[model samples]
Every structure is written in C-alpha cells, then in structure tokens.
Target chain A: MSEWALEVEQLAKKFPGVQALRGVDLTIPRGVTVGLLGPNGSGKSTLMRILAGVQRPSAGEVRVLGRRPGRETKERVAYVPEVEHLYPWMDVDEALRFTAAVFLDFNPDRAEEMLALAGLDREARIGDLSKGYRARLKLVLAMARDAELVLLDEPLSGIDLISREKVLDGFLRGHRPGETTVVITTHLVREVEPLLDRVAFLKEGRVVLDGEAEALRAKRGCSIEDLYREVFA
Target chain B: MTWDFDRNRPIYLQIGEEICRRIVRGDLPPGARTPSVRELAAELRVNPNTVQRAYQELERNGVLFARRGQGSFVREDPALVGRLRQQIAAAAARRYWTEVAALGMSPEEARRLIAGVIHDDKSSLR
Candidate 1:
C-alpha cells in the first residue's frame, strides 16, 4: 500500500517543433485509479507515451516500479494507445498470440476472458470489427496483462452509451485490488469520475491541478466535469 | 431502497442516514445483510468508494456489523430503533426551525403553518 507505483519529476518532451511537456511532476501510489484529464493536444498522450517508453523524454526523470521506463518497466507496464494501431489484417486470436509472445506477464486466460466479456469474436479479423469494437478489443488486450501499471488513453471515447458502459465494466472486472494501477486519460470526465482515485487536470503541457478526487470536489463545490470547464474555460 | 440525494451534502453521510432509517422502519429487518458495495453503487450509479464509506460508517456507529468473509448485517441492538427514531425527529425539528426562521416566520406562525400542513396532508391522504 505504501509503495510508489509510478513517479515523474520535472519530465519534459519535445517534438520536431513543439514542446509537449514542461517540467511535469506526478506521483501515483499502488492500486490507484488515476484520471489523467486534459483537453486535446494538452500533452496527456505525450506524457503517457513517454512513460510507456515508446518515446523518450527530452529531459528529466521517470520511474515505474522504482526503475526507468524502459525494458524493465516495459515488461511490467501495459499501455493502450488512443489510436487503433493493431494490424487490420490480423485476427483477434492472432493479435493476442503476438502480444502474449512479447509481454511475459500476458495472461492468455485473462485476455480470453476480457475478449469474451467485451463480446469480440476471436475468429473475426480486426478490420471486420466496428471502430468501437476495435478500440474495445485493443483495450481488452492491454488490460489482460498482470502489469503493475496500465496506461489507457481515451478508453471511453468513440463508443455508444451502452457499449461505453460495457467497456468500462470490463476494465474494472479485469483488475484486482493491489494487483494493478490504471491511469486513464480521457476528456469524458463525468463518465469516468466514479472510477478515479486521483485526478490530474492538465492544461497546455502542464498539470495545473493534481490531487485526490474527493478533495478536488470539496474545494470547488462542483463535479469533476464542472471543475474541468471552470479550469479550461 | 430508492432515493435521489442532493449533491450539496456529502453522499456517504446521506447514504448512512438513509440506511439507518430503513433499518429503524423494518425495511431492512434485523440480521438482514446489506447489499454489496458494487451492487449498491451500480444501483445508485454512484462511486463504489462512496458506498464503501457509508457502509464503514454504519459499522462504526453500531448500526451494522460485518462478519468476516460473509457480509455486513443490520445490528440487533434492542434500543437501536427507538434511538434512531428520536434522532430523526430531532433532525426534522432542526431543519424545520431553520427553514421557518429563514422565511421570516415567527415561532407562533411557524407552529401554526406546520400544524396546517400536517393536517391538510393527513386529510388529503384519507
């Protein structure tokens, strides 16, 4: 309970021309569901990508489970990018086989359970599923791992109401207490507020608000959705 | 079992009071197990943490007791129902007084208004 699951200190990232991150600091304890809140292009994805080791930070430090966010952390962390990057030609079973071959912690049983829960057929090709189902399938793949941390970027976006609720339920059902840390980045604050333990409000490459969900709600006397509008408006 | 609470008050506290009231009214009889946190949260469309807090408070207040690996059940204290009824009555009086004062009604006028409303409500129900 006392262990620090992930930590970032003065983290910064630079693209070809834009500075996406500017000295951001965040600390997440184990077993917490953190909501990474921000508008589009507010460095939420860049921060997540950097922590996933898909992109290196231009400066500063990041530690996942007390190790650098590289091979060591990569083995223990599961990341779901916002975009559908899975090969359209690959079937669901083939994708899981490839993913299981890559991540040591990948649980085939858990993956199959999540797939079944998400109602995605293993025989169907990725290109055949609807965009919403495709996103859900990718999410299920990421969540099936017994990783220390799971980074999800906009897992609720682009889905109908009924499907969105089902997907959210699958995410929670896949996680066990003290076994996984989930960082969900989304603009749909109201939909995801209940699952959040801590919330970080990012605005223009900076985290302007970061704290426990209840404390933030008490301070503003408003829901997280209203707080976002007040801060970003 | 059905309520739409105002967000102005803390949700957990309201849930705790509502549960106690249910117990006092025999809606949840003594020894009856309370709903699981997930069940109540899903039913209320509220955070599970909020429901957990309410259940914790209920246990602490001696209104409920948890059996390990089983579930929380309404406490069988002999005096609990009477005690809770008094507390609810006191709370209602406090709210009524405060509201009447805010509306600029004198004590006598407030009392008369309360009597009139209760009488009208009873007659209408009959």
Candidate 2:
C-alpha cells in the first residue's frame, strides 16, 4: 500500500480580495506528523480548511485517502480551527458529547482518558475555563476521534509557554501509530520542529519549501529557525 | 543519566553519542536497562520523541537492543563502542580541518594550535 494519506496537486484557492493558495502541491504519508509552517497571511489556514472540507478550492485537485474531500473525507479528517470555535455555553461533557455525535469514530473512552490526563473537570463550561483548559479541551476533542488525519490549526496559539509545553507533550505522547496522521500548522517553528516528521514552509500563498524536516536541515546546513528566517526574511 | 544538551549538534545525534559514551565508560554496562525513553526525556528535559529517535539510531547501528515490551539495553559489543568513537572522532577531525583551512592557517600552525588547546586543558589532566 502507498504511504500517502493526503495528496494535493496544483491546489489553488482565492478569496474575493486575495488569492489565498496558488498551485500548492503536498503529499503527506500515513502515520507521520507534518508541520505546516508559514508567516501571517500565507494561506496555511486556507489550505488546512480545504483539507478539512470546511472550504472549497478555486482550482486544482485534492485527494484524501484517494478521494475528493466530502463526507467520507470529513469523517477521516479531524480538524481543529485556529480560532476558538467551541461554544461558550457548552460544558466539558456537552462538548465531548457534541464531538462524539459528529464523528462516527469518536471514542468516548479516549475522551475520558484525555480529560483525566489533562486534569480537566467534566462539568466545567468552556467560557468559564481558563485559556489552558480551553486549549486542552480542544485538543482532547480532536484526539478523541480515531481519525486517519488530525489537522490542528495552531493548537498552541495564544497560550502561555508552560501550557504550550504541556499540550505539546500530551499530543505527541498520546499518538497511536498507523491510526493517526497529525498535521500541525504553526509559526512557532522551533517549538514545533521536533514533533514534525516533515515540514512545508509556505509564503505568500505558495509553498516555498517542502521536505522532510531532517533532510531540509541537512540540505541547508542550518537549524529550522535559521532556515525559516532565511526563507521568509 | 544526566545530559547537558547543546544547540550546535542535533538532539538525536547527541543522544546517540551520550549513550555510546555511557557504554564505553562502563556506566551503562552490557545488558543494563539503560533508562527508559520517558525517564531520559525527563532527566534531559528533552522531548520523548527526540529520545526515541536516539534509541532508534542506536538500535539501527547495533549499539542498543530492544526486546519488545522490555525496554532498550546497552549492547555487549566492546568493539562497537570503539568503532563508534573512531567514527565520531573522524567526523570531528574533518570539521576541524575544514575550519582550519577556511581560516587560512597552515597545516603546521593548525596542528600546533590544536596541540596548544589540548595542553591548556589543565582541569582534564588533574
């Protein structure tokens, strides 16, 4: 069997005012973590949204598990948006139930385990919870599903360093091989590099560089941070 | 199992070297349960995935053994340790020579400078 779980070819998307993505080609394999990195307004989120089936592309082809993005793809793709989208009125249990209801493969036991591991109370409301708790809740919800592709759109954005560290550790450690393919989009290049099997650096709606993380480093003879600065500087 | 990580070398390579050093120095003897990935990660303040890469590299090179369910153990081959040390030294020497030449230093001057640095290591001798 081929390793590629999500493959995109000449994928392009445009907003009314801007061309968000232009001819973006990507091939992410199964069981590997990919880092989608870019600066502000680089269309990382747009590409992620397209993969998650939240947004439609202007042109080009995309295949998740060798099919178009739709109900089947959505079922296999677990997406957490960059912005906080959870309902403020929903309590922890309600949120879990809501997610469980949406995804057919959502594992309640896994959600319960993650909630305990993250030290989150089952009854706490999303609005009343702290930023750390909110982030943890989102992560738990995304990870609870046994999806083939888990797309985290800036999972650690706006969190404190301590909380970010904890969240990263939890997400990295809890992954089960062959069952999950996690793609994290972030500008925090240094913090996210270690967890990434491959990295794609986007700039101005185009993928300027893409390769295996270690191979990219070897090719440039520089750290990921140095390379990032060089590419986007 | 304490490791002071540095920024220059990659984390996984450093981990492989540290494990090799322990094996060579007899700190982690053959068949010893050389710290679990979680334990070493906590001690070194590094990601467990990075530590896992280090262990993977060692296993690939035959410097460590894993008996599934049971954790990784230091390899019993003394010759493997010697070979690894030599390979590392060769790479270091090549890097040093490349830098020395880039600095426009003659072979004699570079050798003398290197020897002088070694001579200045008073703490190691003591």
Inter-residue clash pairs, candidate 1? none
Query: In every candidate, what fraction of the native interface contacts is reproduced?
Result: 0.08, 0.02
Q: In lDDT terms, which candidate is top? A: 1
Which candidate comes out best when scored by TM-score?
1
Interface RMSD of 2: 3.6
lDDT of 2: 0.82
Candidate 2: stretches off by over 4 Å: B1-11, B22-27, B34-53, B68-71, B78-126
User: How well does candidate 2 match the true structure in TM-score terms?
Assistant: 0.82
Query: Which candidate has the highest DockQ of all?
Result: 1
How would you class the docking of model 2?
acceptable
In model 1, the runs with Cα more than 4 Å from the true position are: A107-113, B1-11, B14-18, B21-27, B41-50, B81-126
Candidate 2 C-alpha lDDT tens digits along B18-61: 88878767788878888988667656655566688889988998
TM-score of each: 0.84, 0.82
Tell me the lDDT of model 1 at A170: 76
